[model samples]
Target chain A: MTPETVTLILDIAITISLVVGAVFTLVGSFGLLKLDDAMKRLHAPTKASTLGVGALLLASILGAFARDEPSLQEALIMAFLFVTAPISAQFICKVNLHRRSCMTPPEPSSDSTWATLDTADAGDAPAQHLTPEKG
Target chain B: MSFVDYAIYGAFGAVSLAQLLAMVRLILGPHTADRILALDTMTVNAIGLIVMLGISQGTQIYFEAALIVAMLGFVSTVAYCRFVLRGDIIE
Candidate 1:
């Protein structure tokens, strides 16, 4: 294909991708409005916004490169974003759970059963023994 | 000077509207955690908007500004969440 044709194709692809990205973002925003809880609201934005911005960034890079310019720096921003957004979301969810008295703890399961046992054992053994009371 | 430019502008407008709705949630949220989630969503929308602007204007600086915003948003969310949980922003 000719250079002009190639550039045109790239531009079209980028435009389509960007439009889709925006749609996902708008859905995420609506999710924040509709979801019943903080954690549920958290899921929509991360899942949608991360990919939405990722698509837009990719478009930027492609558009730049198609026009014979450098483009990877935009990709770098996206790279950092993908890595960090989830961790921040996790942090917020964890802290929110801690602050609210009404929050329910996760259901007891075999995976966390040991942790509950450890806590119980610590609490029950209130004796301050210097050397395990002459048993 | 083409359909693509119009498409880009349209995308930007949609995201801006999304951001505004997110702001409503931020302003009127019943709980602190709800507000924080809104803030996080707003930041993500802003980053997307900036990237779209950078594409339309053909400037790389917008990406840099977005990077800064993303970093700050992450730090502040973590700090505020810590404060919420432990009554302090730091240990």
Candidate 2:
């Protein structure tokens, strides 16, 4: 293919990627606003918004190449986001669980309480030992 | 303008709208978890905006900024959750 054809193809790819990313992002945030429950709200941004950002980053990478200045910096952001999105989501879930903001999980057959709700034993809570004595 | 420019502009508009929606959620969220989730979503949207800006400007300087924002956002989200869960972030 000619240079012009390759550039055209890359541009088209970038444009398509940008459009997809934007639409997914808007949908994700809209879901966040419209969902009636906290857990349901969590479902939207973590997955859909992450995918949206990934698509945008993909477009950035393609755009770099289109400009004949290819770089991989966008990949760093993408990888960090992919790795951390679920983790943050999990933390948010834990917060929801701890606060009892959503439906509680079914009881475990063996454990008496869910982990998030379990209180630390006095013997096991080192924080108790770390308190400064009052004068 | 070409279709590509239109697409770029449209992406900007859509992402900005998304950011606005996330902010509305932040303000209207009924629970603490919902507020934290909104903050997290906002950070992600901010990163998107930064990336889009980089794309439009054809610059790489914003990469570090986006990465830092992502890192701090995750850390802040986790810290907020931990604080709410255990009443302490470090414990």
Candidate 3:
């Protein structure tokens, strides 16, 4: 096969792979919106998007080789992405959970005010004042 | 439109829409985790975009950049998560 023909085929294949990867990413993003909770939302992007990017990267390597260029740099990029994205997501989630649970103690003055308000409200209520008194 | 190009464009359109939805989550999320997840999703999609760009341009540099982004994004997420869980960065 001629170099020209090989290049054409590689181009077609790479295009197809990249488009599929993009579609997967889009779906994963949609999952982020549709899922009810953080953990559930985590699933689509991490799993599906990772695979999608991998496909795209593979296509890149193929295209690079077709063009007679070295692909080590591209490979390195993929390696970096694969390693970092998930770990970052995990850290943020853990921080969020911790923040939600940390409770602040009420100030003493505010506590006293609350107590006074409660007692005043309770004292003003008549205890069955409408009932007829027993003779 | 050529069949292949049409398919590629369609995928791009769909993914863009999905990225928008994820952005909404990032903006409206009540908790940090949800926002972080949404951001991660966006980064992953960005990698996909870079791949597409690399393919279209017939170059390898974009792909290399994408891999780097993926690595850095992951490391940052994990580091922040650890910070949240432990409430301390050292020891």
Candidate 4:
């Protein structure tokens, strides 16, 4: 392809992706505030915001490519965010459960139960020793 | 402004609006976890803004800053949750 066509393609890609990313970010943030339950709040930023940032990073990659600068950093950012967002979401969910901050947690399957504050009713035990004792 | 320039402005404005909403959630949170979520969202939004700004300015340095912020945000979120879960981040 001619250089001009390539640049045009990149420009279009950047525009669409950035716009999509920003809108997703806005919606996710809105959900964070508008959702009544803490767990519902968790749903917004973890999933939608991660995707939003990924799209923005993609746009940045295209922008950098168009400008003939290094684009790898944008890819790295996307990888890092994708890898960590879920782990952080898990941490946040655990925090909510441990603190009993949410209204109600989902019921664990019959095979095994979760160890939330309500379920782990043992008194006087320190938080550090929360794991179930081995046989 | 050109259409491309206008697009950049719109993206930045939207990301900024998202950041504002995240901040409001952070302040109005009745639960600590909710606040943490809001903060995490803010961090991601900041990354978006930084990238967009970099695009608008035609620079590359902001990518490093974005990467650093993403790493730090993850670490801090995990630490906060660990504290809430077990009262300490490190055993």
Q: Which candidate is the best by lDDT?
A: 2
Q: Which stretches of candidate 2 lie over 4 Å from their true place?
A: A120-135
**What is the C-alpha local distance difference test score of each model?**
0.77, 0.87, 0.64, 0.83
- Model 3 residue B29 CA deviation (Å) reads 0.5
Error of model 4, residue A127, in angstroms: 4.7
Please give the lDDT score at residue A116 for candidate 1: 20
Q: Each model's TM-score?
A: 0.85, 0.92, 0.69, 0.89
lDDT of 1: 0.77
Q: DockQ (C-alpha) of model 1?
A: 0.39
Clashing pairs in 4: none
- Model 2 Cα RMSD, 1 decimal: 5.3
Please write out the lDDT profile of model 3 over residues A21-73, one tens digit for every residue.
77677777777788775556777887777777777677667767776875656
TM-score of chain A of each: 0.74, 0.87, 0.62, 0.79
Report the C-alpha lDDT of model 2 over A24-115, residue by residue, as the tens digit: 99999999999898889999999999999999999989988988898988999999999999999999998777666787689899879877
Candidate 4 C-alpha error for residue A108, in Å: 3.1
Q: Chain A of model 2, TM-score against the native? A: 0.87
Candidate 2 colliding pairs: none
Q: List ranges where model 1 is wrong by over 4 Å.
A: A101-103, A110-135
Candidate 3, residue B8: the lDDT equals: 58
- How many angstroms is residue A75 displaced in model 4 relative to the true structure, after the best TM-score fit? 0.8
